[model samples]
Target: MCRLFSLTSRDPVSPMLAINALNVMKEGHDGSGVGLCLRGLGGPFGEMKEAPILSGIFTEAGLKRLSQVSADIGLDPKYSMTFTPKTPPPPGTPKRGTYLARAFDIPDAWKGLAPEELAREYTRFRLMLRTTGEEQGDMQVFSFWPDTLMVKEVGDPMEVAAYLGLDNKDLVARQILAQGRQNTNYAINLYACHPFFIQGVCSMTNGENTAFIPIREYLASRGVDGYCGYQSDSEVFAHILHYTVNRLGLDLEYYKHVITPLTNEELDGHPDRENLVRLKQACRKLVIDGPNCVIGCLPDGSMFMCQDRKKLRPGVVGGKPGVFAFSSEICGLNAAIPDRDTSKDFQPMHLDTAIVRPDCQEVTICSQLQALPHLH
Candidate 1:
């Protein structure tokens, strides 16, 4: 199993805060890898929210190739943050070339496109770079979107953060998600790290995905451009979310229903049963099986957590008014926000999805057995 930690705040916080929280739950996950995704960025990036930021690891050759490709696509470089470790990586950690998070200006030729069209173009550009890097084994792109940055490395979470200079003031953000992987299911490939991102949706999961192959085939058949990579089974969780809410135009609440639908008997007598039945039938292939707990962030900066039908994995949501954290263990929560009201901390059940809006004010628990309240 992996350890998951996510935080959303009204003010920007360092990614190291999330990394430290993951360390408190070190017993749950072996120190095999660390993955982080930061959204609603602050610091230098706050002024460049309109530009798309490409976050990845690159070789010297890969960097040159990336520049050529971006120019070919008419994307102009705006600003960039490149980190080179001051010292060699610690023992057991692989040595890498350069870490980059470069922002690009949307070319004048594509500035008039609609929002959806523009988003599709970003995905295309990212995938093209990914494919080019794959053939040469020189690049590993994690995310390409505005106000977001991602980093994934194979090592202990805390060590990786310090080694990558993640404590830099400019790397702060209002929301961050971190995962400490145990390396139980797949080989230690950097692309298979947690906290996966596509477009504006990002998610990390703990526990095995028993229904991965079927779900992968279903998602791939949708003819989506960014749905090809399946280096990790948990990747489908994020894609399923993108399909349900972004592509299908469904509300965020329906995402839980699509992945862990209530049974026919459980759905009986519910006010929205008709629609729920239709959703369940139509999205049956997307239903997930196995012990898992998922924490995800949407494009709007909202964060959420849900459990499998059996509630096999552990998770908790707790904090004060200005900041909230979703962690795999309560101890992790206490480590991140120690002053929170302990009584208000919530542990979601099989039928519950605990959500904290971008405001970070309160957590709303929506249940599968009842009609969901209108959430905006």
Candidate 2:
């Protein structure tokens, strides 16, 4: 399915490291792209971004039409705000459109059901999009890659197709990353994240759950220690996580938390499959005392210019530039952190900086993953 995944180990990858990786994959998939905005800009928590083309997606004319149609059912002023859709750019325009509800602040009951939530929100977003998602045309939100990893160095399309065993490159647009293994048996086409269009009723893609509810149930029942979620940006992620944790009455220091990918099936449902309750339980015990984790992820190369803009200072790896990258690569990192040049020849950084990072950043999802080879 959606192939993005991260591997964490106290000896290697930690929770902070996982968050950084997840941040890289999700840096670009923000509320601005979706046309959502929060009322208050400076709340303690992160504010939502207004989708770039809010006015265009929901036009005055379209709102009028919706009003008239809704008047028949008294769904007027009560939901008038729902009528004003974010505007959509006309055809042939570089800028695409956003969903109307995305920009509007409404009850979770009023928004689109987010089916894509888990380790690889990006990959799941693509997968859900392909199954039942839709977005602004300009954004090409549904264009998944034949292989997400091949994007590491910007290789030719043909080269990517060759590595992913893609017979019909034309059929795939969004990136879908997966590692090449000698005995790979993963059912790679079952990604739960997919593009979705919001409607009056909150719904999700490919018959998945409304939001990450299914994933939550999966994790809670399995006793996993990590949390899986999606937002417009890292700040929004921070906000949501901050609020949710407070709601649960748990402080940030209860233990180390590792975020990771829950399989696509887990996001929606693994029909005919048993839950991974025991594995999740083990995860909780491990993280309740520690915060290390392996988060699922994929790099958004589009931010090649804004790499380190959101990276936390006093980085986890000290001065290893790309270790806690905002985006995926150093060139991408260069865009975010213009001061540091990863290209500079050996500036005397940690040896791990040169960890032969592969194009497919996907590593052993964790030896722990192997422990539950049959999690489903």
Q: lDDT of each structure?
A: 0.90, 0.23
Q: What is the per-residue lDDT of model 1 for residues 206-310, given as tens digits with 9 covering 90 to 100?
A: 978989999999999999989988898999999999998888788778889999998889888988888889889999999999699999999999999999997
lDDT of 2 by residue, 91-154 (tens): 2222322323222232233245453222233234333333332232221222222111111101
Clashing pairs in 1: none
TM-score of 1: 0.98
Of candidate 2, the 10-residue stretch with the lowest lDDT total is 199-208
- Considering every candidate listed, which one attains the maximal lDDT? 1
Per-candidate RMSD, Å: 1.3, 16.9
What TM-score do all the candidates reach, one by one?
0.98, 0.26
